[model samples]
Target: MGEENNQTVVTEFIILGFPSLKKLYPLLFLLFLLIYVFTITGNIIIFTTVLTNYKLQIPMFYFLNHLSAMEIWYTSVIVPKMLSSFVSENKSISFSSCMVQLYLFSSLGASECYLLTAMAYDRYLAICQPLHYSSKMTNLTSHQLASGSWVGGFLSPVLPVVLISKLLFCGPNQVNYFYCDAQPLLKLACSSTQFTETAITTLATGLIFSSFLLTVLSYIFIISTILGIPSITGRNKAFSTCAAHLIVVMIYYGTITAMYMQPMSRFSLDINKVLSLLYTVVTPMLNPIIYSLRNNEMKHSLTKFFKQIDKRKN
Candidate 1:
């Protein structure tokens, strides 16, 4: 009751999005708008291409399709609001709105972590155990795995967001982030945030490290299997299959771990913002390009997709 009463002191938060870039709002708006359009368009293309193409119906591409879909939602949660902050004079988000945003963004992030781990496992099966891959990663199994990731992702952030909502925000309603991020929001709470901070850190660390460990283990077996193949061309072909996913894993895990594993005070607000952008804005944009450029089948499907559109126009 007291917490609720104290919360009434600050009803909304001012999202101080790059206050240092105040003069360049228009240019930043245009840049982020272009990136946002490209991200949505790119992921949609990947999702549609994987769905329509008969040849790309294997387990690996199946997971990629789910990944593209998730990325679309993940980026959508953050980027659009960020674009609004750039253009609109009113940079405020209501208390309820902020909590909702935090829940969605964190949920999608957790979902991506699980989804990436699942993708790694799929690649491991395909590369390390080709014979059993078909039987083990059946249509039903793939759907379950994909569905499980989404379920896990959404459920992971519920407790954290609930705890945050109960925190007493008595004053200083400014969030020094482009979005309603957990760390920045926690900073504004007037009540004792030690327990909440510890809970977040523990949950985040467990989730991130466990998923990262599984991915690394999968890659280890994958690499060992590839190295044992006698022919150079055969080994190269095997390596090529999982390379894009591995690169993405490294990039995704790298930025997120650096940002979340340590105390926020270790990095300046500007640094934190930049790190957040890498995972939130830049990674989604890079996903389709990485997959399309690295995989021949994806490239072929993309070409066919565009050609079909051209034919329709003619």
Candidate 2:
């Protein structure tokens, strides 16, 4: 009787992603397909370029390799499901499958946050304290930092997933969005979400806010050091190196903050979905382009890479 009673309370969720724009489905499908292909290709290229180019074997490129890897998984976590939703009439995920998606997506997202922080600190040491940079960010230290980011990122989401698993699902099983997310999953829990929400919020705050603060602080010091340069050319050159990092940081953090920090009531559900898409899909697609376009080293490496390929072909 008790189990039956609990089952009656909740069943599933209705995911209303991109709300019934029947006309837009075809266009949206093609657009997202292209975006996914580009995102995968771009990140793979960056990862390969960094690995093969002897010049890019430094700490920064090491971090870039991990970031590219994260981007690959991160974009994969949401985009494929989203694209499928556009074409398929039935948008449904099994309870177990939803949990898996949630776990992997949140894990990758948290990992990227810490990875970005590590990258920022790498830049800080390189730019602001070039004298001690080599010793401070030694190969061993870089390996440790990179390993920590991956481990920490994986651990951060485990608690929430465990907590979520304890909840019962009774009736409404439809998740309104293309993929599983914490917010949507929370809404479907038959049990009270007070404890789960509080726990997830605390973890997110610690992971996102702390990493963001550290990155911001590192850049502040970095900007100050760049400003201290006496020569205009020197300052310009210095700022250019950091500019790509800053731009990507702003776009990523800005969208994330906008999406997660706001009260649910303020925005429509569709708006929330769009914002989520921006951060999860659009940003990953843009990272390599933003980083490579402004980076002379990456461009040079890419050119040399293509030339080498051409020589081998001939």
Candidate 3:
């Protein structure tokens, strides 16, 4: 059935990115440029802060350093090209380039989910199993956990992305959005996509579900232990550390849950585009602010570091 539909394979695709706002493209470009600047600078600050401060050499901050590093690549996967599209009359992306974007976007997104789970587990150990936390999350173990997230993230999408990219696209050459997402790519394929669709679905489901479940379970244990504290100060202190993590988890997972958890037939392109913006753009920009500003250690470190720079200048 699929072979019959093949006529001519498309070599490149034109992206109709945010076509609804044609008149406002310049303004949107400025907005995106500003966002990219802040996202890059803020995440870099967190990454550098963690590296420079010996006091932050613990597992929690170690994982955070990796998260900031991941955010840099995560948003970079889409934002740079999307930013280019706003100004360039030609928004066409070669088929290979589109697949690369798809792969990186998916890989980094998966890595973040697992990284969040890792952070939640760290909090669980710190709050629920304080004594064992030190021995359990040793420096080597911290490196291993951080490495595992990156490895899992990059590897998870390889097979699916490769398989999907190889699918014949003797169809329309215009993708109605900025990036080449899996579902949109599959829709463009001239071949039967049931198998590819099933594979992508299974991989995505396993990745999102497993990480989300672990994060939820870890938080349950953390909250239970926090409530068990005898004094208000003790409870507040315990909750305070986890509060930032929880806020981040909510923002990250909330958007993803809305985007991915929808039934396949019910996926509205417009809605997905909006939700994608939330996770891919907004969340990356907000991470450093949420994690750094809310935590006492980060505030103190950044304040002192800036003061030192000022003194040196004088």
Candidate 4:
């Protein structure tokens, strides 16, 4: 449906991003601006390093490469707009722009869920089914899993966006949050949002929790297998491979569950914004660090990558 129709009077929305911190706009802007740059730069480094370094061309790094690229797109979707709200007074977003933002944000979030699951499963095979790791996680298989993740994630948000777009918003155009989130938009709907809310919640639960369940199950097996290893060094090595990913999963799901899994309308708007920041801003920056810091191979690759760059300049 078109944004402007007889039933819907409000064609745009004012995103009241962190209104409680309005007095500290300059500090917040500078802070998140630095974060945005770091997030983009860090993920780019990971992506480029994984792609070029021959020794890092394995299934784990392959997935990490895709994840780094996604993080770039993911942060690009929301952070720039957030910075705008911090710097400029014009916090208004057109209806179409809002929907597009919501769609992209949700799609990338969903893709990450599936991508993380794929990574977990890859770790599972590497540790638990070592005999079959190579055959099971072939290049083609990795390609399929990663492509499926992106496809499924992008498709998951289509119905919700379409339904929300059709909702009537007669009076309030003020979205009391950082982004064009479904819950906040629903709160401002002129029409009854019972069905829309139910639909979005149901889809989110299935999408988010199911991926969580799969990832957990894979890790459970991986942990059990690690414990069964006869040598302490072997167990440590096995655990190290997946430890960073496990921490990342916990933080990602923890924040997402807190924000989107419940009735967010009942929560304080500031709390909601904080929860949003954990995943949208903080997690992306931390991911590459977690992976590179924990994985010796990744660190070696990164060091080699920089040395090569310096050599080229010299």
TM-score of each: 0.97, 0.93, 0.96, 0.96
lDDT of 4 at 128: 93
Candidate order by lDDT, decreasing, is: 4, 1, 3, 2
lDDT of each: 0.91, 0.84, 0.88, 0.92
Q: Give Cα distance to truth, residue 122, candidate 4, Å.
A: 0.4
What lDDT does model 4 reach? Answer: 0.92
| Residue 71 accuracy (lDDT) in model 4 | 94
Name the best candidate (by lDDT).
4
User: Residue by residue across 5-94, what tens digits does model 2's lDDT show?
Assistant: 755644334545676786899999999999999999999999999999999999988998999999999999888878887888777666
**Tens-digit per-residue lDDT, 1-314, candidate 4:** 45545554888999998887899999999999999999999999999999988888998999999999899999999999989998888999999999999999999999999999999999999999999999999999999999999999999999999999998888789999889988889989888888888888889989989999999999999999999999999999999999999999999999998877776466777788888899999999999899989999999988998999999999
lDDT of 2 at 238: 86
Q: State the lDDT of candidate 1 residue by residue for 156-228, as single tens digits.
A: 9999999999988888999999999888988889888888888888898899999999999999999999999
Worst 10 residues of 3 by lDDT: 259-268
Q: Which candidate, 1 or 3, would have the higher lDDT against the true structure?
A: 1
For residues 1-314, what per-residue lDDT tens digits would candidate 3 score against the true structure?
A: 65565588799988888999989999999999999999999999889888999998989999999999999999999999999999999899999999889999999998999899989999999999999999998999888888899999999999889888879888698898889887667767887888888787777878888999999999999988988999999998899888888999999989887766654446878888898899999999999999877798988987887888799999
Candidate 1 accuracy as TM-score? 0.97
lDDT of 4 at 263: 64
